[model samples]
Target: MSGVARQIDRPRRWLVVLVVAVILFAGAVVAPSTGITRMGPFGLFAWASWLHVFGYAFLSLTLVYALLVSPDGPALSAAIVPIIVVAYGTSLELLQLLIPYRSFAVGDIFADGLGTVVVVGVWTYGQAAFAALGFRGS
Candidate 1:
């Protein structure tokens, strides 16, 4: 491979590790008790549901950075981010056990997994859509 290629790819090893670290670290912080709800037709799925979209957004950003460094495409990054997220999430849940006001909620893990699926789905579809629009890449 070219030296330039090596230069680009080499940094990604640490970049991925760093991004994963930041995500995991951030998850440990207890979220303020902001009631995620709404009064719309499907209120139950409004605010809390929106969190999934935010998760997708962050995951997408992470994928873009992943691609920028390695050019491996979003699919590969999508496949890996969740494992990092889940391990970190589970650890955070366990860590919260130490707090007097918090308890582990398995539903949060399900929500996180669903959010991850959303991220992967959007990345896959986004790549397809961009290709359909005549964009292609390495």
Candidate 2:
């Protein structure tokens, strides 16, 4: 592919990934809960909490990748991506309040924010570390 085509392609691919993440997030949050209250030896709540954490983490990572691959990507993406992801999570939680089978939970929002922060922090640190080691990428 030509340079221009490659550049456009990269952002498009990340955008597709971001869209898929959003769809999965929506489905998870909006779907009615299964009556099964236990998984293996663990309570369903425990698994759900971890799911919220990891799901938002994955969502935020995709957002960062999408922004970074864009032609006009921001220099402060590490700082911005978490805020965006957390906000999205919060909005989804609020949305759950209206669903008959789903209810909003502040704990879920906290978990989502925690996941976003942890992932972004590690990503930013890793980038800085790589730059310091003279292995920076364009």
lDDT of each: 0.60, 0.75
Per-residue lDDT of candidate 1, residues 35-120 (tens digit): 65463235555554455335534654564456433544334555676676566556766877887766676765666667666676
After superposition, candidate 1 runs with Cα above 4 Å error: 1-28, 34-41, 45-53, 56-60, 67-77
TM-scores, one per candidate: 0.59, 0.79
* C-alpha RMSD for every candidate: 4.7, 3.1
Clashing pairs in 2: none
Query: Against the hidden true structure, what lDDT does model 1 obtain?
Result: 0.60
How far out, in Å, is residue 136 in model 1? Answer: 1.5
Displacement of the residue 48 alpha carbon in candidate 2, Å: 1.1
Q: Candidate 2, 46: how far from true, in Å?
A: 1.4
